[model samples]
Target: MIENIISALFFLAGISLSLYSVFMRYVMGGSQSWATEIFTMMLVWAIFIGFSTALRDDKHVSIDILYDRVGPGMKKVCELVTLIFGIAFSLFFIWTGIDMVSTAYAQEIRTIDAGFPIWINYLIMPIAGVLLFIRFVEKAYRFFLKKEIPTEKEAGSEWQL
Candidate 1:
């Protein structure tokens, strides 16, 4: 819930910044050069944070044809496989993201308009990767060890005609 709130705030901030930038450029007849870069940074942070929030809520997109057709045991196996894939990919993302950020920091790279350190912008990659990794671990524990099953409420209510 907290993650969702933070992600929403970042998303709204990005939209607000974009709208303000447009207003300044058109209505005010000029715009601060840093506005676009700041907006872009906000958008990047929002996207990565949103990814983690979605994973935490089990809202990530997936095709469930096979999962729906499978038995309970098979479904559990499928979920385990999916979680393994997610963990592996997230670890890779974290590793590479750290390397990229380190390189940027070492080179003293800065943003074009604001001259802010580029590494700060790239920082979200690792943060999101860590969040995703932790979420996947939590899910795997609940699914395998806890023997928990998704309730109808969690799955969503079905329509009765």
Candidate 2:
């Protein structure tokens, strides 16, 4: 239920921000700096939040050639290795994101337009990092526990390309 809500929020926000960007470019007469800044921050938030959803559903992109050719046991080992790498990457992102947000907060920098606090934009990194971390843990747990895990098929089956 919580996952559903988060997914919906990310989806809506992403769509709205994207539309705003388009509007700023076409509809708005002048190139408003604030619009771009806000849109960029929202875009980052949307991407990270969407990535969290992807993590939950095991929808992250990967090269499946080796897995397809190799036997199931080898594939399992590869999966384990990939999981370890993913966890490490996520931890690194979290640490860096925290450091970045901290610096931004301490500096109290604001955007050139509208005097928007830059820290608000920087906040997205840490927030997304935490969300990604949680999603990775949840995925790891489900993988090991032999529980039913969400997949791209379940979460994004409607998408056709």
Candidate 3:
């Protein structure tokens, strides 16, 4: 719940910064170079954070043609396969992301306009990957132990409480 709120706030801040940048450029006839760069960094963070949120809510794009036609037993099999694939994919990102962020930090990389440490933006990749991995684990547990899978509605309603 707290993570979701943080993600939302991050997204809102990005949007606000972008709009302010545009207003400064067009309406005020002035350039705010740092504003755009900062907004870009914020956008990167928001997108990475959004990936886990979407995965948790089952909002990620998926084709259900075969899944819909399968029986309950087959559905379970498919669910397992899907979970395995998701876990593997997320792990790959986590591994690569850590290396990328480390390299950026070691090199003392900085953004062009804001001069902020580039590793800060890259850090989101590994963080989001871990979040995604955790969500996959939860789904796998529910499927195996409870023989239940979350429906789209149930997934979306997780934050309602």
Candidate 4:
């Protein structure tokens, strides 16, 4: 819930500011490059945060063509494979994100226009990585240890939430 609020704030601010930027550039015969930079940063934060939300909600994209045809054992196999890949991807994101944030901080980097700390923008990467890692592990526990699986509705979206 909190994550959703934060992400939405960033997203809405980005959209609003970008529109303002456009208005300033064309309508007002001026430019606000700083606004552009800020909005870009905000949108990036929103996107990375929302990425983890999708995973937690089981709304991440899955083909499931083969998975749909498989039996219970095969379905488990597919899920295990997906979870492994998801975990690996999350680890990679975490490592790369840390390296990016550290290097930017060490260099005292700032945005080209807005002058905001570059590391601040990079922070969401590792945060999202951790979120994804935790969610994937939780799914693994539910499926393997608890012997649970998502129902059809949980696995699929039939309508708006």
Q: What C-alpha lDDT values do all the predictions have?
A: 0.84, 0.73, 0.86, 0.87
What TM-score would each prediction reach against the true structure? 0.86, 0.78, 0.88, 0.87
Write candidate 4's Cα lDDT for 22-140 as tens digits: 99999999999899888988999999999877877767787877788889888778878889998999999999999999999999999888889999989988999998898888888
Better structure of 1 and 3 per TM-score: 3
- Per-residue lDDT for 124 in model 2? 70
lDDT of 3 by residue, 1-161 (tens): 65677788888998999999899999999999999888887778877888877877778899999889989999878888999999998899899899999999999999988899999888988998998898898888887797566665775698586
TM-score-superior candidate, 1 or 4: 4
Q: What is the lDDT of residue 10 in candidate 2?
A: 60
Error of 3 at 12 (Å): 0.7
Lowest summed lDDT across 10 adjacent residues in model 4 is found at: 151-160
Tens digits of per-residue lDDT for model 1 on 83-131? 9999998999899889989999999999999999999999988988998
Pairs clashing in candidate 4?
none
A best-first ranking of the candidates according to their lDDT comes to 4, 3, 1, 2
**Which pairs clash in the backbone of model 2?**
none
The top-ranked prediction according to TM-score is 3
